[model samples]
Target: MILSPYLILLIPVLYLIGWIYWFLKHKRPSLNMPRIISFHKISNTPELGGTFNTVKQFESFIRFLKMNGYKTARIDKILAEPEEKEILIFFDDAYENIYNEAFPIMKECGLTGVLCPVAGYIGKKNLWDRGLKRFRHMNENQLKEMSEAGFEIISHSMSHSDMRRLNKESLIKETTESKRTLENLLNKKIDYFIYPFGLYNENVKNAVKNAGYRAAFASYNEKNDKIDSFAIGRNTMYIIDSKFDLKIILERKPLFLFGHEDQKGRIINWFSRFSAVIKI
Candidate 1:
C-alpha cells in the first residue's frame, strides 16, 4: 500500500515532537559536571536478573558519551577534581567475558573502568545467584593485567554476600579480607569498596570504613553529593540499556532512565536489613 502525501508529511512532525519530549525529560543543565555510573557483565548471558551490555553496544555507547562532551575518568581523578566534567565507569562482578569482550573495546576507545570482584570467587563461578545460570569470574592473572593496564581493580566483598546480613565478625572479614587479598594480588593499594547487591546500612558502611577503605559505592540512582564516601550512589547499566539510556545517566537527567531498583532488588535489601536487625 502506498502512503498519502499528507500522512508522509506528518511523519517528520511526529518525529520532531518525540525528540523534543525526550530532550525536555532527559536534558541536564548541569550535564557538564562529574558523575559516577556502573555496568556489569557486558555480555549477552541468558540468566535471570543478570545485567549485561554487548561489546559493540558498549563501544557505541562510549562514543556517544564522548561525543556529548563527557570525559571518562577514574574515581580518584573525579574525586580530586570535582569541578571537571567526567564520568567514572564502574563494573561490578569480575566476569571473564569482560576481559574478552568489554576490556578490548575499552582499550580501543582509550577508556578505562573500575572492576569490583568478589575475592572468594576469583576464577570461580558465581554461586551466590543459585537459581540463575552461573558464569566464571575473572582469574588472578586477568585482574593483574587489568590493573596494569590502568583499570581500577576494587572489591565487591569476599563472596558477593549481603553485607547487612553479615555479623560484625563476618562483615569485618568480608571487608578486610577482600581488601587484603586484592592489595596483595595486585601489589597496589585498593582504596574503594563496592557494596555487593547494592545493599548496605550504617553498620555495613562503618565496617567498610573501619576496614580502611577510602570510599565505597552503592547502586543508588543518583549522584553522590560528597556526603559520605562509603555510601556513594551509582547508576547501573545493563545489556538492555541502549545509547540513549546511557546518555540519560551520564547527563544526570531529572528522571531515572535506567538502573532503577526493582522488586527483587528491594527484597534483597529488605532481607539484608531485617537479618541484621535480628543479628542473624
Candidate 2:
C-alpha cells in the first residue's frame, strides 16, 4: 500500500468542504417557540463537564436578550401561555455562581431566570455527580433572596440522583418531597420540576406529574417540533459554544446545526448511572 503525504491534507480538506456544504445547503428555521436556555455553572475556570458558561458569556446572553427586546416571563414556565419570544433562562444545579455571578448580571439586564436547586444539597457541595467538582449549591438564604427578587425556584429532584430506575416510593420522595422542600424553603409554591441530569422516562414523568407539578423540564433532549409539558426540553449552553453558535440558537436556527452538542450531553447523562459507585 502506497500512501501520499498529501492524502492526509486532502482528508481534512474534504471534511471541510462537506461541513460547509452541509451547513449552507440546509435551511435554517426560525422557530416560533419559547426560549428556554439552560446553564449549569457560571465560571471561566475549567471543569470536568462542558456545561460551564463563563461570566462574560452569561452577561452577554442576558444583554443579547434585552437588546433584542426579549422579556423574562414571570408566569409558570410554559404552562398556560402560548409560545412566544419570552426567554426563560434556566440555571440547573443552583450553583452558588448563579447567586454570586449570574444573578447580578441578569438583574442588571432587567431579567430573571428559573433556578433549579437540588433540595437535599442546598448549601452543600454537589455529591450527586460522579466527581467532586467541588461546586457548591446555593444556600437557603441565597435561594430566598433570588426567589424574593422574582427568580423562579424549582426542584432538580431531592438528591440529584438518577431517578429513572427508582421505585414509586423513592420516586415520590425525589419528586413530591423535593417540591415540598423548595416550597417550604422559599415560601412559594414550587410549580415545576427539572429532572436531575435531564434523565427521565415515562415512569419518571409520571412521578413528576403525580407530584402535582404543572410541568417538568428535561435538559438537552428536545426538538422544537414538539413541546411536551411533562417532558419539555431545554437547550443547554456550554463553554465551548462559540458566539455564532449562541446567535444561531437565539435566532432559532435549525436544531441540526448545533444539536450534536446536545447529543453529547445525553451521552453524559447515560454515564451518570455509575455515579453511585464511581468518582471520576
Candidate 3:
C-alpha cells in the first residue's frame, strides 16, 4: 500500500525530532584521555547471585585484549602510572575458580591481572547478604599462593557495600581495616583498592587516601586524562556471546566514558534499562 503525501512528510520530521532529543539528552564533550579497559571476576561459580563467566568466554576476552595491545598490570602498578593505557584487567573478589580454572590459562597466555578481594569475606558469610551459593573468597593459603605466583592481591572492601552510602566511620573501617587484614594475611602491603559496586564519593576518595591507599578503582569507564589519581576508572566486561559486542567495545574510544560527575551508575543503568525495554 502506498503512503499518503502528508504521512510521508511527517515521517522525516518525526525522525529528526527523535534524533535531536537523543543528541541533547546524551550530549557531553568526548573525552580523548588515555583509557584502560578491564574485566572483573572470572569464575565458574557466580558471586552476589550473578551468573558466572564461562571458562571459554573468559579466555576469549583475555586473548582479545592481548591481541589489541592491552597489558595486565597489578592494581598498584596501574595506579602508580601517570596515565592509563588502552587495556588493564582487574579481577574483583578473588574466587577459587579463578585459581582453579582461569589462572592456569592466563599464565599460559602470559597475561597478568590485579586480584582485589573483600578481606572480611574470605572465610566469613556473604557480607553482601545476597544469599548463600558458592561463596568462593580466597583463603590465606590461596592468597599466599597467588601472591607468590605474580597475581597482585588488593583490597575490594571490608564488607563490599556502596561507599557513597556509608558513613565516615564505616568508610574508614572498610578502607583501613580491609587493608590491614589483607596485609596481615598475605604478609604484603595492600596499596590498591577497588570500590565495591564501583560506588564512591569525594568523602570516600578522601578516606581511601587517608587510609594510605595508593590507588582506587571505580566502575566509571572513561578516558582519564584528568582523572583523580586516587579515584581511577574501570570498564566492566559482561558475559556476552557475541564477537560484535567485543569489537564495539574495543573500537569505540569513548564507549565507556562517564558523563555525570556525581552519578557514576546513572548512565549505565539507563542504557541497561533501555536495552531491556527495546529487547536489545
Candidate 4:
C-alpha cells in the first residue's frame, strides 16, 4: 500500500521534534567559576544502577569537565565551601572496578570525587551481584586506599533500599548504622549521606539529619541554591549517550530547576530511563 503524502511529511516532522527535544534535554553549557557540578559512578562495568561506566567514556567526561573550566571536589570539600565552584562526584557502593580501572586515570586528570559505599555491603556480595549480575562492592582495604587518595568516603545506606518504602525504624537504621560503620572503618568523620535509589521522603531526610550527617544528596536535576541543603539535587551522567547531552544539561538551568516542578522528578526519571534504553 502506498502512504499518503501528508503522512510521509509528518513522519519527518515527528522525528525532527524528537531529535530537538532530546538535544535540548541533554545539552550542557559552559559556565564560569563558582558553580556546582557533579558526576557519579566511575566503574569499569555498568550495573542496574544508573551510572556511566567504561574508562574511555569516563576519561572523556573528565576532559569535558576540565575543558569547561569546572573543578572537582570531594563531597566534604563542596559542603565546606558551598559558594566555591564545586563538582562533587559520588561512586555509589564503591565498586573495586573503579579503583582497578578508573582511579589512576581520574588521578592523572586531577579530578576528585566522593565515594559513597554501602557500609554493610563492603567486602560482601552486593545485592546487585546476587541477581543483577553487577560487580561486588569494594573491600575495606580498597575503601581505605581511596580515602587516603583524597576521596571522601560517605554513606549510601546499608542495603541500598528505597527509603520511601521503608518504615521509620528501618530508615533510621539504614541511615545511622551506615554512617557509623563507615566512620568506624575510615577512622574519620562521615558527614554526608547519599540516598540510595534516589528515593526518599521527608522522614528519610530527617533520619539522615538525625543520623549526624551534615548533608544529603538526592537525584534531582536542579541547581542547589543553599535552600535545598538537606535534599540537594543531582544530575545523572548516563552512558551510551553523546557528550552533547552535557551541553544541554548545563545550558538549561531553569529546565533543571523546574523540570520536575509539576511531577516532582518522576518525569525526569522516566525520561532518563527512556533515553538509556534508546541509547540517547
Candidate topping lDDT? 2
For each predicted model, how many residue pairs clash, with residues at least 3 apart or on different chains?
1, 0, 1, 13
Could you give candidate 1's per-residue lDDT for residues 1-280 as a string of tens digits?
Answer: 9999999999878756755554454342344334776766666655445366677777788777666776677778776676445778887888898888888877877788889999999999866553245678999999999999999998899977777888999999999999999999999998999998778889999999999998888876233323456776666666566676676666545433322322223344455335333421
Each candidate: what lDDT? 0.73, 0.75, 0.64, 0.66
Per-residue lDDT for 151 in model 2? 91
* Model 3 / residue 8 / CA error / Å: 16
How well does candidate 4 match the true structure, expressed as C-alpha RMSD?
6.0
Estimate the TM-score of every prediction. 0.77, 0.82, 0.72, 0.74
Top of the candidates by TM-score: 2
Tens-place lDDT digits, model 4, residues 1-280? 9999999999869756754554365343224212333444455555443454567787787688778876776555555554334566667667777677768877887877778789878977655432135466789998999889888887999988768889989998998888889889989999888887666788988999888888887776333333366776665666653466555454444544323231323454565444334421
Clash pairs detected, candidate 1: 52-239
For candidate 4, which ten residues in a row score worst on lDDT? 28-37
Report how far residue 236 has shifted in candidate 4, in Å.
1.3
Q: Which should have the higher TM-score, number 3 or number 4?
A: 4
Sort the predicted structures by lDDT, highest score first: 2, 1, 4, 3
lDDT of 2 at 42: 93
Error of 2 at 137 (Å): 0.7
